[model samples]
Target: MSISSMFSNKTSRRGFIKFCSYIASALALPASLVPKIAAALERKPRLPVIWYSFQSCSGCTESLSRAHAPTLEDLIFNYLSLDFHDVLQAASGEAAEQACEQSMREHHGRYVLVVEGSIPLGAKGAYSVCNGLSSLEQLSKAAKGAAAIVAIGSCASFGGLARAAPDPTGARSVAELMQDGQIMKKPLVNLPGCPPLPVVISATLAHFIVFGKLPELDGENRPLAFYGNTIHARCSRLSFFLHGQFAESFDDEGARKGWCLFKLGCKGPSTHNACASCKWNGGVSFPIDSGHPCIGCSEPGFWDSKGFYQPIRGNVPLHS
Candidate 1:
C-alpha cells in the first residue's frame, strides 16, 4: 500500500500533514519543507534495512523500542522494510542468516545498515560471533553492500564501555573498524548516547527517507541538528550555572532548589545532545530534570573518562 493510503484510512489528511510538520520541525528542517517531507513519505519506496548487533548490551534496541503510546517509532518501522534484526525478528540460526543474505543481495548498494554495539577484534574476534562469524566479519560483509550506515548508541559510535580500560575484548567502534579495515565506504552517521533518544533515531530515518542523503554531521559524525549545542546551553539550571550557584551534594539544599549540577559531577557543560530539549520518555523528563547529573554518555570515552560523581570543574579531565 502507498504510505499515504496506509495513514489516510486512519486519520484525516490534515492530521497526517500536522504529523509530518511536527517531524520536520523536530529534524530542524525549514517550515517550507513540511509539504515536501509529506510528499516524500507518500511517494518514496520503503527503504530496506538490516540491523546488526555486536559486542555490547542490547540497551539501544530497548531504547528504540520504548517509543511511547501512539508510537511514532512503530510507524517509522512500518515505513521501512526491516529485513533482519535478530532481537526483533522471529527467525533464527540458518534461517535468519539466509534472510539477511537475501536482503543484502536484493537491495545491494541501496539498503540502510544500522549497527548496534561495538565490534571485537581481539582473539581473532572470538569474543563475539554471529552465525559462526566474528562481529567484525559480519559487519564488513554487510557494510560492503549498504548505501548508508548508522552507528546507533555509544557502543557502536566510540567503543563505549566494551573498550574501557584493560580492553580485553579489543572492542572498537564501527568507524574505527571501518577505518582500520578500509570498508563501509558509504555515508556513515553516529547517534551516540548510553542509548540514544528514540525520537532522534526516528527523525534521522525520516530525514534520510525524505532527502535521500545523510543529515549534516559534526566532527564526531553525529547529526549536527541534534548534537549541535551543549546540554548546559539548553539546561533548565543554566541561570544557576551562570550565577555560580551550584549543588555541592546530591541531596543538599542547593540541589533541592535546582541549582546547577556542575559542582556535583553533571557533565552537561561538555555533553552535546538533544536531551535538554527533546527530553526522554515522550518528552516528559531527562536525567538532569530527574535530579541526576548528566553523565556525558553521548561523548567518546565517557566510561573511562572517570568519576561520574566527581565534579566536572576540578576533578574530571575534559576531552573534546
Candidate 2:
C-alpha cells in the first residue's frame, strides 16, 4: 500500500491536522511550523523502519504500544512505515528476516534503524541471538545501510541493567558497539529512559520526518528539547525542595501534604529528562507527581547508581 493511502481510510483531514499539531507541540516546535509539518506528512514517502531487539524485556515497546492519547496504531499506520518489528509483526522465522532484508535492500542507506535492547558481546554474543545470528551480527548488518539509527531506551542507549556489576552478558550500548567495530557511521540518537515517554518517541520521529534531520542533541546524543533541563528545575515540587519542606518517608505527613520527595530519594535534582514536563500516561502524571522518587532511569549506569530509594546526597555520585 502507498504511504499516504495507508492513513486515508483511518484518518480524517481534521485528525491529520491534529496529529501534526500534536507532533509540533511535543517537539517544542513553533506553532508556525504546524502547517508545514502537516504538509510534509501528506507528501512524504513512508520512512521504512527496522526495529531490532536484543537484551530487553520489551518495556520500551510496551510504552509506545500502551500510549492512549493518539494511540500507537495511529502513529505506526499513518506517520511511519514500521517495516519490521519482531514482536509486533505477524511474520516470523524466515518470513520476518526476509521482510527486513527486503527493506534494507530496497531502501539502502535510507531507512531508519531503531534498536530496543542492549547488544551483548560476551561469549561471542551467544547470550542473545535471533534466528541463527547473534545480536552483534544482526546490528552490524542492519546498521550498514541505515540512514540513521535511534537507540530507543536505557538498555539500548547505555548498558542499562544488562551491564550492571558482574556483567555476565557483557552488554554494550548501541553507540559502544558502533564504536567498537567502527560500523554504522550514520547519525545516531539516543532516547534513554527505563521506558522512554511514548510522546518523546513520537515527537523525535516527527521531528525527523518534518525537518529531514535529527533534533539538536545533548552531549549524550539525546534530543536537547526533551533532555535539556534537570527534572528539578521544571518539577512542581521545586519550591518544596528549595524551602526545605521535604517528605521524610513515603507515608509521612509531609508526603501527604505533597511536599518534595528529595529526602525520600528523589533523583529529580540530578536527572535530566522531560518527565517533569512531558510526563507519562498522556501528560497525566510522572513518577514524582505520584509521590514516588525519580529513579534516574534515563542516565547511564542508573541501575548501578547507589539505590533507587536512597537519597542523592553524600552517597550518590552526581553525573556532572
Candidate 3:
C-alpha cells in the first residue's frame, strides 16, 4: 500500500508522449522540442503525489478540488496520481497508513509531496496528529524521498493564522522546517494563499508538466508567472483606486457601483497573485470583484496583521 497505490490509471509511453505534445502546444513550446518533450513525457511516467494536511482548515483542498477547468475528478483522473490524501481517501486507521507506506515504497525516489497547513512543533507536534503520528514526523518522512515538494496555502508556506502572536501551537512553515533540517534535496515550490485560486494551482501544475521542472520562482519561492505582478496591477477597479473612490462599507453605493475596495483594507497593492486574471469559480468572480477587499491572503502573515479592515499604510488621501 505504498504511494503508488494512489495512482489509479496507467499511462503508456505512447499515450504520455501524445499528452506531452498537447502540453507543448498549450504552453506554446517551440516545434523543434515538441517531439523531445513528447518523448520525455511518454517515458518519464506520471509523478505520484502524497497530500498531507495539518493544523488548519481544508480550504486549500476545497479550493483545489473545486478548480474551474479541471475539477477534482479531472485532477484525480488525469493530472497526477494522488495516492494517500486522508481527506479524500476512503481508507482509514491502519489501512490508510498501509496505503501511504505502500505508495512511498513503490514510488521510492520519485514522488511529489504536497503539504497543506502549518505544523505545530512547540507541543512536540502534539497539536495535530494522524493515526498516532505527528504531522512533522509524517512530513519529514515523506519529504525525504520526494522528487519535488509543494507547500500549498499560506498555512503551509508561511504559517498563516497559526503563527500569530502568543503562538501557543508553534505553527511553522515547511520552508522553516526544511531550512532547519535537511529533509530533501529536491526543489521546494511555495504556493501561498489562504487558498490559492484554482487556476493558479492548475497553472502551476501545468507549468511543471510542460517545462519538466519547477516554474521560475520568486524570492519567496512563488512562481514568477503567477506571483510576479501585484493584484493591483490588473485590478478591474484600478481607476477607482487611483481616484480614491472606495467602498465605505459592504453595501455602500461605491460597492454596488463596483468601486475600489482599497479604503476597506484592500491589500491588492501589497500582495501578489493571479487572482484578478485567473479568477475563481471558473472566472466568474474574485474577492474584489465580488465586492470584498483583497485580504492579501496569498501573502505570508496576512492573518496576524494589525487589522483586516484597515487600509494599507493608512495615509493615501481620497480623490475627488
Q: Best candidate per lDDT, number?
A: 2
Q: Write the per-residue lDDT of candidate 3 for residues 1-320, one digit (tens) a residue.
A: 22233233554445545545544543345567777754443344555889999987999989898875546665566666788998999989889889899989999877778899999998788989887879888988998878788899999999988987877899999999888873554688999988987766665675665466787789999987678888988899999978868788888898899998887888888889888877788778888888888888888788877788888884443320
Instruction: Decide which is better by TM-score, 1 or 2.
Output: 2
> Per-residue CA lDDT of candidate 2, range 1-320, in tens?
34357456677677778878887777778999999997887778767899998999999999989765358887677667898999999999999899999999999988889999999889988999888999988989999998899999999999889999989999999889777764566799999999998987888887887788899999999998889888888899888877879999899999999999988878887888999988988789999899999999999999998889888876432222
Best by TM-score: 2
The lDDT values for all models are 0.85, 0.86, 0.78
Tell me each candidate's TM-score. Answer: 0.94, 0.94, 0.85
lDDT of 1 by residue, 1-320 (tens): 37656665575577667768877777788999998988887788778889999976888888878865225444544467888999988899899889999999999998999999998889998999867889888998999999899999999999998988988899899899777764656799999998999878877877898898999999999998899888888999888877889998988999999998888789888899999998998899999998999999999999987789877765332222
Better of 1 and 2 by lDDT: 2
Which residue pairs overlap in candidate 3's backbone? 1-102, 1-103, 2-101, 2-102, 2-103, 3-102, 3-103, 3-104, 4-103, 6-83
Clashing pairs in 2: none
**Considering TM-score, which of the candidate structures 2 and 3 is the better prediction for this target?**
2
Please provide the root mean square deviation of candidate 1 (C-alpha atoms, Å).
2.6
Model 3 weakest 10-residue run by lDDT: 1-10
Q: How much lDDT does candidate 3 score?
A: 0.78
Q: 206, model 3: CA deviation in Å?
A: 2.9
Candidate 3 — which residues are off by over 4 angstroms? 1-44, 314-320
